[model samples]
Target: MFLRVLGLLICFHVSIVSATELLVEKQAFSIDNFATFNGNVIEEVTVGWESYGELNEEKSNAILITHYFSGTSHAAGKYSPDDPQPGYWDAIIGPGKAIDTNKFFVISSDTLINAGVHDPNVITTGPASINPATGKPYGLNFPVVTIRDFVNVQKALVESLGISKLHAVIGPSMGSMQAIEWATAYPDWVERMVSVIGMAQTDAWTTLALEHWALPIRLDPDWNNGNYYGSTPPLQGLTHSLMLITQQALYPDFINQIQPQHSPLEQAPLNDINASHSAVQWLHVAAAQRATIMDANHILYLVRACQLFLAGHSGSLEEGLSKVKAKSLFLPASSDLLLMPYMARLAHDTLARLGKSTQYAEINGIQGHLDGVYQVQQQAEKIKQFLEN
Candidate 1:
């Protein structure tokens, strides 16, 4: 009986060790002076990143995973097993998983102006970061950045690790833009690319949608022209902006099903003024909950950056796409209205017309644009096949 108990203890210990391995830790890399696509420069910049799996002797097995607009570098692990949430793409990245850790060394990084700069898990130089020149948070002084700037920083981070070439560069949404940028900016550095729910440039509709996201923040009195740091933030504006994003990020059907079925005119008892007895009220509450943790400036900066996203910043789309030499995979969410599937289809069509090696698939899920992250399993097999090829 004692021997059996010892065996059980050993098994339990091993389980503990395995769970610990999946917990993500943040790491930072710095550049002396990082130049922006706009010709401005940050005297010193720091980028936060996380890595999973091993870098083999050949160093040819590296994969770069880019994060979405609201995501961090913690792509595929837990902070702890007891933590409520795993990394955003935990579903598709791990040993024996779609982007198998055993065979590939995966790297992900927080983009400049990443959403949660104040969060312990993230580190980025944004409006919230101190200016080495002034020793105060940059606030509105932070130079505007573009998608190309994001790619430039990632290039520095990759090369710093002694990695000369990436086996693949993959991402969903904003990350997809970065992946495409990598292939276009340095075709020789990337071997394969996976662009999910992404486009070569922001469409007219997307640009208009992004304008709405920034309008609220600009109108908020507390915003004070983006200098509201260390004081009252633009909570109302931020929450409203997030509400707009949440409403659009998920499918209408999915949200309608989750929303309580109740008459819009129904009012709570006078004594219970705080009760959310309607769908709109519930949505507001949810948005507020998410907004409270996010930085308004970060979102504003990222939104503008996304609006300015052009695969070929200074050239025509066809000219930029014509430079891509990496084998590409394009996955569009079937129900996405935010970054519509048509956008992905256009890119695929363009690449095919150029006679580029590419594959196209649609993620048929109810999650809208979010299906790229939430419904990754639907396309896991295809991704594995593409990477293996």
Candidate 2:
């Protein structure tokens, strides 16, 4: 049983764990006439998925990795030797690393309305995707997607592979929400869940925080209420949104080192209102580079989906989590300012109080929320131990 459960958590914290490399391919999963929780229907839905290792005959070794809000299906490996970086979790998902692909079949996929639509590697159908009916972008016409919607799509992908149950579902940030949803919505399919930088519910505080991400995009003149598909895309608003996301995702301690702050007497910003600090300029350059490949509407839709998140959409946290049957672990970053650690603890305490098997741990790092990604190795053994026990 321990061996079986160990397969549940095999991919996370990419590129820093070990030097193992696994070549991977991005594949597609498509289903027609899919119905959503809101009674809306997508005539055709397609998403990109990538897998590592081999699936056992019984398919019990399968583990599904849900990507974060800013991530994609390429959980590990380089598409080619010349590619710059491996997938986000390459360090952990390789043949002999913590995920140990040699022992477990690992799958990770892009979600609906993924932020990286313009990136050639990402394949997802969203507002950015053209509608067959109109032969144009869906834009605002796209149905509101919920975290449950993401899980349902994943379930479809899993079933198409002839897998009846998952050894585990693991993810960080938004990925955590999807993992938790999977446990509640299909308790029988998930045996274990590891949520890093995760929360069982988006509280009132979080809902508003998520709204802040959408505010800039909505305020963009080019947005035109999400109607900028064929016209000039809302680059300005998208840039600001990305900037906000980057700042919120990192702690000051880590960010303080990224760019050196110039002295007031040395920089022109002190004398001129038009001039700005180097740090501000640095973030703008970075955000502009990233904005080119991201869609403004997709970011807004993702934010709305996150704002509406309530675990299984069960109306309340208690009712939503009451459906979970998996052994759960919550790992929140101690320095995180966004999605503060207490949210995870609140969920953990609730689960324990309800007699559900659960565990909690804090990852300490200077990167704050990003620690859940770059610093997960700090708790790799703890995760391995949880899977084993």
Query: How close is each model in CA RMSD to the real structure?
Result: 7.8, 5.2
Worst 10 residues of 2 by lDDT: 1-10
* Reference-based lDDT, residue 294, model 2: 87
Q: lDDT (CA) for every model shown?
A: 0.82, 0.83
Predicted candidate 2 versus true structure: per-residue lDDT over 1-389, tens digit per residue: 00000001123232345544578888999999989889999999999999999999989999999988988888788887666567766656677666778878999989998998899999999999989999999999999989999999999999999999998899989999999999999999999999989898888988887888889899989999889977998899888888788888878976676555655564578779898887777777778778888898988889988888888796689998888999999999999888899999988998898899999999998878878877777787787777656
Cα-based lDDT at residue 151, candidate 1: 89
TM-score of each: 0.92, 0.94
Off by over 4 Å in 2: 1-18, 264-266
Give model 2's clash tally.
Answer: 3
lDDT accuracy of residue 181 in candidate 2: 93
- lDDT value for model 1: 0.82
Candidate 2, lDDT over the whole model: 0.83
Model 1: per-residue lDDT, tens digit, 181-231? 999999999999999888888989999988898888899999999989889
**Candidate closest to the true structure, highest lDDT:** 2
